[model samples]
Target chain A: MSDTILFDYWRSSASYRVRIVLNLKRIAYRAVPTDLLTRQQKAPDYVARNPQGLVPMLHIDGQDLTQSLAIIDYLDATRPEPRLIPADPVARAATLARAMVIIADIHPVNNLRMLHYLKNEMGQDQAAVDAWYRHWIAEGFAALELMAPENGLFGCDAPDLTDVCLVPQVANARRFELDMAPYPRLTRIDAALQAIPAFAAAHPERVKPA
Target chain B: MSDTILFDYWRSSASYRVRIVLNLKRIAYRAVPTDLLTRQQKAPDYVARNPQGLVPMLHIDGQDLTQSLAIIDYLDATRPEPRLIPADPVARAATLARAMVIIADIHPVNNLRMLHYLKNEMGQDQAAVDAWYRHWIAEGFAALELMAPENGLFGCDAPDLTDVCLVPQVANARRFELDMAPYPRLTRIDAALQAIPAFAAAHPERVKPA
Candidate 1:
């Protein structure tokens, strides 16, 4: 078995966050795509490993770890090189807060499953669903645009947890065709992150299966 | 000014998470209530301290910190007493994963703002809105029931981050009148957590304004 295996889907925001961290730290891991479109993630075998039946389950250190941020925390703890979070406690907290504005506040509400629920169960049409999707990203991005520091290309000169979260979410915003005009700073950061080989490698398009 | 101040609201699941952690750690700090109903959190002065206009912004160590989990991370890093997270990296990751199941997946979907949006924007009736609220909790609690461990009093021997998050969510579930019959393990854990003085004191009702 490889030292690490990431069960992922190309389009999952959570999965993308971990991929960015892994690439940024140069950790070698084999990717095993759990295609979300086909409900492969809901398979009995996959659920046995992660009770949540969620994608981006990382098998490492002889254990199966779920939750993207938690997996990133493990990687940062084990591989301290090119630290994903800042060394200063306050900065670390702020970075994490910035990350959660996406992870907790924005991403989950606009999750594929959520959109599906809105459509299938709640009888929301595509236009309504799309509006709901953009509404959240806009709400979150508005705050993040103001909160993000001008210290570096992203939140800081060096990519931290915030950028790991930002790039994937911005990708999703584009997928939904949410206007990027309101978030110039976020757009600039995304552009900067795209130039980095690590962030570039983790892009959904790069990981998508042919 | 006191070294520490917590801008909080009684019913916010995010704020409740931080209050539970503070009480559990016996950290002394003044609570400055920010009334969400009054939109006090969105006030210019409050927004200056926390751009997100969210409650449970902790002002400590000569800085203002947002996000409940981020604030808790700062506390766990600085205080390190009766540690809220496990010492081991893998264990910490699992605890955080369990916590995020509530933080990211469950809580945000059922937040007050979302409910308001459902009513005002979507024209959802009270019945429909309540159903929406309960639906997310049931979905999350079902998974959490299996993810939680068979350990002592709390999720583990001592209530860790998982329990801090779990108890508040269960409280919200109860308030929403969500059917709890399906999640026996979570119910048991919440009951056990309630006996802890810290958890008891942090209950929403206990913190309600006179």
Candidate 2:
């Protein structure tokens, strides 16, 4: 067994993504929390580990993988117990592409750093910032809702990698109280995925810190 | 022969990524420029193809695929001319993780919409806005510089998808006059890749509206 450690913050959706995947794979790992509230992730040591100063840096056999999607893909490829990504090219592309809809297009637009700039530098109040965040989530999810086959269960069948990434990001959206009425397909899919033990058990509340 | 048409804008690094992959694979494609500055991508007809209103959407046999990395990966999978992503699990993860260091983390943070907010809504001037763009690029490239293996070429033994993604973003970095001097590994690799036909041919200048 490889010695694996994950430096994570409890509330980070990015960290939340890895947690869901590890739980699904039943990978036993230690979680060393970085308190995001105190901005400890910005500290020098943490910066050394991840110069990007992000959360959920997975130290696998001393190799530190930074991006959550890359880390999860690595876990999927290495473990392969219950696969996260699909096997087929077109299908896998769809799975990964839908997942990136959240990771690349939507999430970054609302992250803490962007919010910090909006509030501190831009002089926007909390309401405006919240609106900005909700706008992008709604935008991305709307497209995802339409694209979802509605023909398959859990991110278009039986809980794949896209399913793993989607739940946490949607959970973040829920925390922000974003209106989900515009995205019925996503909400329905979210309901289905959360019903499964693998996803539900990895909720932020279930983690040790809480 | 497959009917492949790439809807692109010359200056779009996202489109440029696909262009490089197509050239690397020696695939025949026709470039149909979608002028982004004129709100062409947002037109009802174009939006029908891609709801997100983004470019680098590839039309192959009537199906359109958006998102640069997704398109590139699709090309890599279907045509094995020049493999764009690593086949090894660990190594592939490192390559993708390194690539996402730019695609996921840095690029979106400075996306056109995000920059729009930094200027119009956030009240940041050109200098502050340029600083903001460079800040994330520098932070991201710094990590990538460390991530680039010395013995390995182009973040791996061969030029992979990560390298394809890296070059365009680095070129964008140079546009802002960002000092890439600090990140020698990336600058070195950029030099290496840029000198090649695929890279040189995919130049934004080589695309339309230059």
Candidate 3:
């Protein structure tokens, strides 16, 4: 009860994004793992608590919040320092557009559930499934490489919501073995994000249960 | 430009959502159709302007913007009246979560590009593609029915971002002929949205090219 509890999976890109935000904001949160591999997200109790049956649901201030970006927004709203969304309207819109390139476009298409469907329901082989994953990441990153802030951050001045989304999707790209050579800017931003203490702490390898 | 120009397609659920928001806010915008069927979004000029090659891109206040929700956020931030995001932190979180259920979960899976990939790349038949479309909408709506606000709106006492996302998704549901009996609340809320002038004015049929 003392710490904000995050119901998350270690390898979930969406969960990873929220975890980075929590660490960035210095908000102490208990990590309660929801094992997607085991289909634990579908359990009656879990489904009742979060109807979306998605990981990265947060319980804080006696309220339940779901959706990684929404949770990040809530954290930013409640804890205004280290602002995740930019102050300028144009910059904010640009940052969000960049973030959505990952959140709504890339990650959703290449997520574990979609990959599973591609393999099982669609009868795609490992190679085909892997191709599907890399294709999306590559397509998304192609655009993001152009749109990312030129100041070496994904957003202006500092790592904003776009950076939070970028690193996780980059991790997914590496996991799927997509060629990173094409997206130099995204790779540079991801490298920068990895150096940040908050992002380093939230790495899936660090959060993965032994 | 005499008015803000929205690069859009009549049948695009994303553009429809933004159109509803513009109407709700009483903002006048000129709709410049981007023919997705002809792959106009991928042409060199269009891709140069919007690297993502997605529609509902807005040219406003001497700035070019992409992504529907991001554009809506930009509108809300600049206009500040009849806010799309709620004032209360918790309420805003809830609203955004519901919106993501559509934006991230449902819409992305059913978008035209995904359907094209399923058919052309994966050799999915019309029936298979239809089943895929219906599967995602049903799964998402099952949860949204529970998470949606009880006052017959998707957010505090009125339609907020969640409703903006919902109505268009429901329009998609109808277009795909998904059974509506399962989500009574969503149907009721959609019915409410249809009565509002803003939502009605943005219907695909009205905006379709003659």
Please give the range of 10 consecutive residues that has the lowest summed lDDT in model 3 chain B.
Answer: B149-158
C-alpha TM-score for every candidate: 0.97, 0.92, 0.97
Q: Compared with the true structure, what per-residue lDDT tens digits does model 3 show for residues B94-179?
A: 88888999999989888898898888888889998898899889999999999866666765566789889988999899988999
Kindly report which residue pairs in candidate 1 clash with one another. none
> For residues A1-210, could you state the per-residue lDDT of candidate 1 as single tens digits?
468999999989899989988888888899999999999999999998898888899998898999999999998998988888776788789889888999889998988878887788778899988999999999999999898766565556778888889999998899899999998888988888989999899888899999
- For each candidate, the DockQ is 0.85, 0.62, 0.86
Tens digit of lDDT per residue, candidate 2, span A90-177? 7677677778889998887788887887777657889889888887788788778767766555445578876787888898899889
**Worst ten-residue run, lDDT, model 3 chain A?**
A148-157
Shift in Å, residue B45, candidate 2: 2.9
TM-score of chain B of each: 0.96, 0.94, 0.97
Q: Which candidate do you rate higher for lDDT, 1 or 2?
A: 1
Which pairs in model 2 have colliding backbones? A84-A161, B84-B161
lDDT of 2 by residue, B1-210 (tens): 448988898887788888989998998888888987887888998878887778878887456888887777777778877887877877787778778888888888887777776678657799888988888888788878877767555645568877888889998899999998898888778888888898899999877564
- Return the lDDT, model 1, position B119: 80
Give the Å error, residue A143, model 2. Answer: 1.5
